[model samples]
Target: MTEILVVGASIAGQTLAYWLARHGMRATLVERAPRLRTGGNGVDLRDEATEVAARMGILPRVRAAAADVRGMKFVDAADRAVARVNMSRNGEIEIMRGDLVGLLHEVAEPEVEYVFGDSVRSMEEDAGGVTVSFEGGTTRRFDLVVGADGLHSSVRRLAFGPEEGALRHMGHYFAFANADSALGEDRWVTMYNLPGKMAGLYRSGNHAQAKAYFIFRSAPLAHDHRDAEQHRTLLKEAFGHETSWRVRELLDGALADPDFYFDALSQVHLPSWSSGRVALVGDAAYCASPASGAGAELAVVGAYRLAEELAGTSDHQIAFRRYEEGHRELVKRKQQIGPNVRMMVPKTHLGMWARNGLALSMGLLARSS
Candidate 1:
């Protein structure tokens, strides 16, 4: 039996483990967090991602836990609806990130041994197996390793190189957090946009708390990605000057809430997804950025395909190559996030007005069709 080590307990990591265990391989999964994280913004399941969920027999569960948001509605600073995206017509489901991860965990955790509150400290590969030292003061040996961690993958850093050379900033930054339910609109996503900035309030009918989303176009800013307090401070500074409707209200809640997520809208574009006995999948390999709205889709489907390649042969090298070849094109296609960024946060006043006009046109077209 080939022992495998998988990093991250993210949707990608959990799904990869599920597939591997389904194929009779029990991989060990490690998450640096002490427990499974809960409460994140909603994510979408589209195209093959929906199929992947169905094949796993977890699609129903996902739908049950879905945000079931009506659609993403763009609003002007005065709080009037400008445009509403027609997600209902797409036949896709939008579930909260935490819900999807939990569903994947239920399917995976029983079959695969999981270790939380610890992480890989160092990894060295030899002919027999790869030696891994853990931060929790333990060592393990595995035949192969896979990094399904998110954009800031520790496995990728240890196996490939530092992140500075790998991460490509997509000229934006985003933040989100849980907010007071009083500000929420039931089953709707209300987004407000200003020049190069956006703020939104999301409330799923199934949940009590609303989610606050904020995004701004910036060159880049200095901050520790892991520091929640720093993230909160940065977000406060980013939104402090905005006099728009509910912007200050949302920011107040976000600053007080510790569950804030702040990061650059960036992508990982690596030359290869593998080095010797180690390889990467999902965002660790190719993040299409959140602007594409395909993160969950790509992560789940990519992990499924990578597991398929691994099962095709006992050799990890061939599996890695095949996985890369099969998945890179999709990454390339999704990473071309052109108008999506502008749609979210237009760069100039004219651009912003044009986006509103286009959204009105799209809404009109949707209603007509």
Candidate 2:
């Protein structure tokens, strides 16, 4: 049996481990967090992702926990609805990120060895295998090492290079945190924009809790990505004084939530997903940005393809090349974020008005058709 070390127990890592275990391989997963990270915004599952979930026997559970968001409505300062876009589509289900992660963990737990509260400190790849050093001062060797860690992947830095060389900034920063369900209309995502900033509330009828979303246009700022305090301060500075459209209440809720997530709107673009015996999957390799609405989909499909290739071949090089070749087109298509960010956070009042008008027309056309 091949012993594989998978860093990060999130969507990509867990899915990869699960598939590897099913292929009769031994997988050990290490996560920096003490436990599974079950908090994040809603993620969509569609196309190949939905098929992957069904193969794992978790599709029914995912459907049952679907967020069931109807559409997004743009509102003005007085909380008047300016325009609404019906996001309802066939064959796609949106589930809270935490719920999906939990479901993935449940199915993957039985066959995989999990190491929580620890992470890979360093790794050295040789002809036979890779030797890994953990943050807890432990050392181990595995036949293969995989980095399913997110954008700031330590494994990537250790194997390929630093993040500054790969992360492409998308001219914005975004945050997501728990919110009071009462502040939002059930089954709708309500957003308010002020110039280049946007504050939104997402409420899912299937879930009792709501999620607050904040996005603002900015160049890259200096801050430790891992520092929670810095994240809080940056978010506060961006929207702390805003007094329109329940912005104050939303900010308070976001600040109060313990699992608040803040990060630059960036995508990972690596020339290669593998270096020697180590390979990367998901956001660690090709993050299409949350704006693309394909993070989960890509994670699922990419991880599946990677594990499938590894299981089929003895040469890690061939497997890695096949995985990259198979998935690059999808990544390329999704990376072209186009006008998503601009539409969500219009730069001026005229742009906002134009966006609203376009959204209204889209809604009308959908109804008419």
- For each candidate in turn, the TM-score is 0.95, 0.98
Clash tally for model 1: 0
**Residue-wise C-alpha lDDT for candidate 2, range 52-139, written one tens digit per residue:** 9999999999999999999988888988877677888899999998899999999999999999999999898789999999999999
> For residues 216-286, what per-residue lDDT tens digits would candidate 1 score against the true structure?
98887888889988888788788998877899989988888767888999999899999999999888989
Candidate 2 ranges beyond 4 A from true positions = 362-369
What are the clashing pairs of model 1?
none
Model 2: lowest-lDDT 10 consecutive positions: 360-369
Candidate 2, after superposition: displacement of residue 265 in Å?
Answer: 0.2
Predictions in order: lDDT: 0.87, 0.93
